[model samples]
Target: MLALSHYNSSASPLFPHFSNDSAGKLEARVTVEGVTDQPNFSPGQPTTGGVIVVILSMTLGIISNIVALIILANAYSLQRRRTKATFLLFASSLVVTDFIGHVIPGALVLRLYLSGGVHHEDSNSSDRMCQFLGGSMVFFGLCPLFMGCAMAAERCLGVTKPLLHSSLVTKTRTKICLCVIWLAALCVAMLPCFQLGSYTYQDPGTWCFIKVLSDTEEVDVAFVVLFSGLGLTSLAVALVCNTISGLTLVLARLRRKPGSHHSAKSHDIEMVVQLVGIMVTSCICWSPLLIFGLMTVIHSYTRSIGDDLLQYQTLMVMGVRLATWNQILDPWVYILLRRTVLRKIYLITKCQAGLRGNMLGRWEPTSFPSSEKNEVNQV
Candidate 1:
C-alpha cells in the first residue's frame, strides 16, 4: 500500500495538487489532471468483480486472523514454560498485526469502492485518509515480514543452541523486541511524511501507496528502494533461519537414543514447522511487490511515457493483490497446520488405507511407526 500527500499545482501529472489559505486551513480549491492526458492511457474504473473479491477476501481474512488470535491466547494460557510462552507472544503479535492489516486498510478500500472510487479532485479529509492508508500499507506490509524473521531467529537459537537460547531469551526481552520491530516499521512508514517520498493514489484509484514513479526526485526513488530492500532482506533472514532450525531438528531426532526423551523437542518441532509455513507464505506473497518496486527503480531511467507506464501501473496493481494474500493465508498456518491437527490428519489417512486393504482381503493390522509412536507418547 502507498500514501498520499498535499502537493502544489506543479505536482506530477498522475497526482492531484492542493492549495491552502494563509492560516494553514485547507482551501476548498484542489486540482487534478486527467490520467495520462491521452485516451489510450486512461485507466479503467475499479471493477465490480474486483470490489466483490476484495470485500469477501478481506472479510474472510479478518475473521481468520481473529480466530488465530483466540487460539494463540488459549495456547498461551495453557503454557507454563518460558520458551513456549515467548513464542506464543510473538505469534499473538503477528496475528494481531495481520488482523489490523486487513481491517484498517481493508475498510478504507471498501469505502472507496462504496463511494464509487476516488475522484479527480479529493477533499482535505480524503487526502488525509489516503495518507493514513498509505502509511498503513507500509507499516502493516513490513510488520509480518519482520515478525517472521524474528520468530525464525528465535526458534533457530532454541533448536540449535538450547543452553544459549535459555540464557539469552526472556519474556521481557521478547516483548522489547516486538516493540522495536513495530517501531522500526512505523519509522520507515513515517519517513514519507518527512519528505523522503510521497504517497499517491495507485492505479484504478482504489488505493494509495508509496509513490513508484520514474520521474520523482532521487530521494523518492531511494525511498522505494529502501522499502523493497528491507522486505527482501527480512525474507532472506527468515529463509536461512528456518532452514537451519529444521535441519538441526531433523539431525537431533535422528541422533536421539530409543529410550531417551526430550519433552521440549516436540514443541520445538511444532514451532519450527509454523515458522517454515510463515517463511514460505511471506516469500510467495510479498516477493512480487518488493521485486517489482526494485525493478521499476532500476529501469526508471529507461521508462517510457505511454504503454510502459500503463504496464507498470497494471503490474503494480496485480503485485499488491498478491501481497494482500499474505495476511489472509498467514493465520491458517497456525490454525490448521498444528501438530495435533496434523497428527489427526495422519491417523485419518492411515485408517482409510487400512479400510481399503481390508475390503481387498489383504488387511494385516500393524503397529504404529516408531516416529508415530514417539509423537503419541510425547502428546
Candidate 2:
C-alpha cells in the first residue's frame, strides 16, 4: 500500500530470472504475481516543468564539469610547484565523481523521457536496461556523497592538525580512501539487485528504484530502508565534519594575538566562509530525497485516508528533483567558491590591461595554507 521512494524499479538486476516469466505465460491469468499497481508508481510522464528541469541539469552540468576538469587537470599537471599531490588527487576524484554522477543518471532520465516511459514488463531488454540504470543511480549518486564526507574530514584534519595533515594525507593515502568509498557505494548498490530488495517504477514515469512501500515479498521493504539509511548516515557524517572544521577555524581566528598579516587573516576567514557555504548547500539540495524516503516509511506522507495520490506524487517529484538540482548546482558552487578560477581567467586576460585590474580585484587570492593549489581552493 505504500509507494516507497523514487528508487523503485520493475525488475531485480541481480535476479533477472525471477521476473523472467514471459508476458505470454501470464496471458491466461487475470493478474500477474508479485507485481503491484504499476500505474500507481508513476501517475504520468514528466510534465513540461520536469522535462525542462532535467534538460537544463544535463546541459549545464556537462559544460561546467568539462571546463572544471580541464582547468583542474592543467593546474595539477604543474603540481610540483603549486601544491602537494594529495590535494590534486582528491580534487580530481571529486570532479570525476560529480561529472559521472550527473551524466549517468541524467542519461537514464532522458531515455525515459524519450521512450514515453517504460517497465521491465514492456520487454526483457527494457527490463535489463531499467535494472542497470537503477543500480547505477545508487552507485554513482553515493560516490559523490561519500567523497563530500572525505573532503570534510580532510578539512577537519587540516584545522586540528595542520602540520601532521600535510605529512600524513599523501597522494597514495588519498587514492586508497577514494577506492574504499567507491567500493562501499558499489556494494550498497548491489544489495537491491541481489534480492535484499528490487527496483521498480516511480512517479513521473521516467525513474525506477527500490520500492519503499509494497504488498509483495519478492521486492521487500528492507532494501528501501537500507537505501534511505545509508543516505542519511552519510549526510550526517558530512554535517558533523564540516561543523567541527568551521568551528575550529572560527576559534583559531578569535584567539589570534593580533599583528598577524591582515591580508592573510582576511583570506583565511573567507576560505572558511566559502567552505561552510558549500557544506550547507550540499545538505539543502540532498535532504529532500532522504526526507521523502523517511516519510514514506513512517506513513505515506500525503497518501493517508481521505488524501489525494496526486498531491503525494507531486511531493515525490519535488524531492527527487531537489536531488537532481544538486547535480546541476555542484559545479557552479565549485566555480563560485574556487579561489583559482578567477586567477586563471585573469592571467589569460592580462593583455587586455583595461579589464585586468577589474578582474584582478574581483578574483583576489584567498589561499589555504594546507594546499596552495587553487583547485583545492574549494571543498
Candidate 2 lDDT at 93 equals 78
Tens digits of per-residue lDDT for model 2 on 161-268? 777887778777888999999999899888865677666666645776555543324334455566667777777887887788778766765565443433433333
Instruction: Give the backbone clash total of model 1.
Output: 7
Candidate 1 stretches greater than 4 Å from native:
1-44, 120-126, 301-306, 349-379
Supply the global lDDT for candidate 2: 0.60
Name the Cα RMSD for model 2: 10.0
Error of 2 at 189 (Å): 0.6
Error of 2 at 120 (Å): 9.4
Error of 2 at 79 (Å): 4.3
